[model samples]
Target: MQPTTRLKKPAGSRNEILTVGAGDRVYESTKLGAVFDMLINHGVPADVVLRDVNIPHQEVHSPQTRISLTQLMTICQNALRLSTDRHLAYRIGASVHVSTYGMFGYAILCCPDFRKAMDFAMRYHALAAPLATIEFSEDKADARWTIEPNLHAVAESALYRFVTEMQIGIHISLMRDIMGPTFTPSEIGLAYPQASDFGLPQDQIGCPVRFEQPANQIVFRSQWLDRSADLGNKTTYPTIVALCDDLLGDLKLRIGIAGKIRAVLLRDIANPPSFEAIAKLLDVNDRSLRRQLRQQGFSFRGLRDELRTQIALKYLRHTTLANEDIALALGFSDAANFRRAFHRWTNKAPSDIRGE
Candidate 1:
């Protein structure tokens, strides 16, 4: 029998919508930064993100604070073209290829087991780059890997193309950290057409590289996935998880009730519903709504700004909406406010965004 498209899982109680949380999975390193970088690159201004978190723009790089899972998921859903964040999680994987860790490089060195290790990196890849994606599969005797993103045209520009190269480079480098430097892959594939664009293959990945392939993937012996390492790295897993916990907490720190409010705002924003109107929809008092948002890491004002930021970018990049029209659609007072906000988020004026 084939895998069913929909499988029912246990819901906690009647009328309760169950959702998957981050602790349920693992994420790859640097991929989280890569995803955050993609959101900035696409349109969500760093200042706005900082403001949403109640941090100054200059402090965004502070290692002390982290963003919340709710915020990350909210933004990812708004900004990404994919159907689900689970599909986006694959960006955390890098090709281990011929490294000393063998096929178990990521699993043995840093992960408790192959499955947990794979899932760990995948779960947090958003902190790295929003556009990165990795897919894993088993076919016959080989484990297959696929890494690529449906990057928007702006993200496909020369700068981001170079960024993609660096992303791939970091992936291999991290693998080398766990595995010996002598590692090589049986076969390597890339979606990019120009090998030169990625620089000399010998220098970049230190292995044979193939370009102009139908997809990007690496095939290796499946047995490697099950092999246990001589040493256990339980200590490493906690440290990584702790870091992720902190990052998620930073976003949660601000606007504690933002999550619940954001949900209602998303539904009524198109129709310009009043706060009292939205509160009635939730069957709660305004005070109750505000308090709930405080728990969710955002406020009504902040979520409204973020929602507008996401909507503006999608319209500008994916649609042919005029600036004036987009401004109106986003409920901005006018095109000027939209232009200013767009500039703040992207560091680029609307004309440049429109390629005018």
Candidate 2:
């Protein structure tokens, strides 16, 4: 048997107190679409799940449509409530094929090796699930993939568990498809506690599972990172990546002026360009840019602050950089000001986030 440990939930579940932002972020509809299709194919009445969640049946069919993360979670919650099986998430995840992801899937399939495929997946992950941010880190012995859901408001709910499980299951299934059936993670770390009658995730995931960890992650041997993908297509890899890029660009445009500005701000995080500079970059005058952003329910300052908060939290959680350096990287005047602003944004200190 693999090693396993469970920790007690922290006082008051700080995660529940943390805000998840405006909850306006969306994911590619294809993910939910694939799951719903599979549910229907399995003789399940998925329509009830959609109806209870207030999601139109037609919306799931369009790959171009983007669904908010909140709605997606609600749908999953409803599915779990209605389905008799405890492992509904695992089943849906296993049924999904890489081709279900459209261009994003193709890009991964065409990579020369697992490492390169992971690079492509990380770069274009938003194309599949914009509401979750993924990070990959590796040392001589192991590689870790950490998934941080942007839906903090639902962090303590069963919806969170279902979605997190489905995500892990999907990745496990995808990896197995690529590396062949024998591959498995070295271990799995989950933020949620184990269910009382939790199905056999260890057996399905092919690894020992740890619960209530600092983060949700999967660990695997580093040696496998260099393994060649069975479906690598060097001849079409470039074309597939280009096509994926186009899809990403189109998605950003669909998000409107606010999304475009957010993209620019992220790219220029070290020294965020001025409003006039960003307007010029977007080929619009300053006044027009402001007006367009306003129309899209965003202000330049608000967007910048949100972006900074996001980057700050990411740095605090994922990197060991000094708070002062993070402040500088975020273009704050100094560490003190960044701390004050961070508190105002999150109602918690930067140190607290890092400590977790």
Candidate 3:
């Protein structure tokens, strides 16, 4: 069946609704900063986009910083508003280089062949784009690289199209950089519907663009998998991969004691660990852990409450669990207590948050 194009509500209409809260997905500032730079290159005022999104202009300059996904979406929405170019994503993506991704990109560039690069990307995608999931599958005739948002119920948002387009364009640009300028996907599939006004993607992607498909994917012949990448570097490959590994490991550690506590809680929310237990798990004594947490501006009870609130929102938005069951899962003594806590956390009833 031919896919129908889905137009999104105007950016202004959805801005407030899409604002992210705690526990929402985030992207590395380096990636978003690159997009911001591109917007400036296109003459979009930096102050205007930053002020609209409530992001400090200096924050994007730091590669180690992260920004919420909603903030990234808002910036894109503002970019579209301030610029006449509908192909902003593609344009920005086309300019991307292997270095833009830091060690992750270099790891790919160092792979001996396209197949090995694909394997590396599939294995370490989290290091590059934690907010999106990339899956690789193959049949007898063709290979597919499917991309989708990692978050639940995000594909319907207007930002999905822009992000998907930018990502697909980056893939195409990377492939051309590695395999040679002649390379192209056999076909491109997008979750969003086609728009006649957006004609440049078809030309830029150098393939037939199909919209409203089963998922966002790039299809190509399986044989291309074995094609040797021109930039493969045997000497530097292992070094770069090891560097990426260290970066990924550091990413976990950088999340801080509060983040570590949240992770522990999320892992076993029904029976969250006591502060003493959590400190032991983190390899520190309770007293030391408490001091460290205090230094980081976090308290154990506050962290637990925040985690519960985030989990409650996740359950309310993504599942049909009853209030009693949700309460039980969250270790509440009763539904009434859970309801009151939910209201206190969000200033809205559980049912109201659940839209029931």
Best candidate (score: lDDT): 2
| TM-scores, each model vs. reference | 0.42, 0.63, 0.63
Clash pairs (backbone) in predicted model 2: none
Candidate ranking under TM-score, highest first, comes to 2, 3, 1
lDDT for each residue of candidate 1 in 1-356, tens digit (9 for 90 to 100): 21111111111222321222332121222333444555565466765433333335443444443443333333333334322222122232233232322223333356766546545544444434234466567756776567664333224344333334444554555544544455444566666665332232444344566777787665455665566643448877667565554544323322223444555666656555777777887788999887766544456666677766766777888888888898888777788988998888768887886684
lDDT of each: 0.49, 0.71, 0.71
| Model 1: residue 199 alpha-carbon error in angstroms | 2.9
What are the runs in model 3 whose C-alpha is more than 4 Å off?
A: 1-27, 52-55, 152-156, 196-200, 256-356
Root-mean-square deviation per candidate: 18.2, 16.6, 17.1
Give stretches of model 1 more than 4 Å off: 1-61, 64-110, 153-160, 195-200, 223-227, 234-356
Pairs in steric clash, model 3: 5-193
lDDT winner, 1 or 3? 3
lDDT of 3 by residue, 227-248 (tens): 7677888888889877876664
User: Top TM-score: which candidate number?
Assistant: 2
Candidate 2 per-residue lDDT over residues 7-61, each given as its tens digit: 1111233121111223344457766775677667767776775865556787676
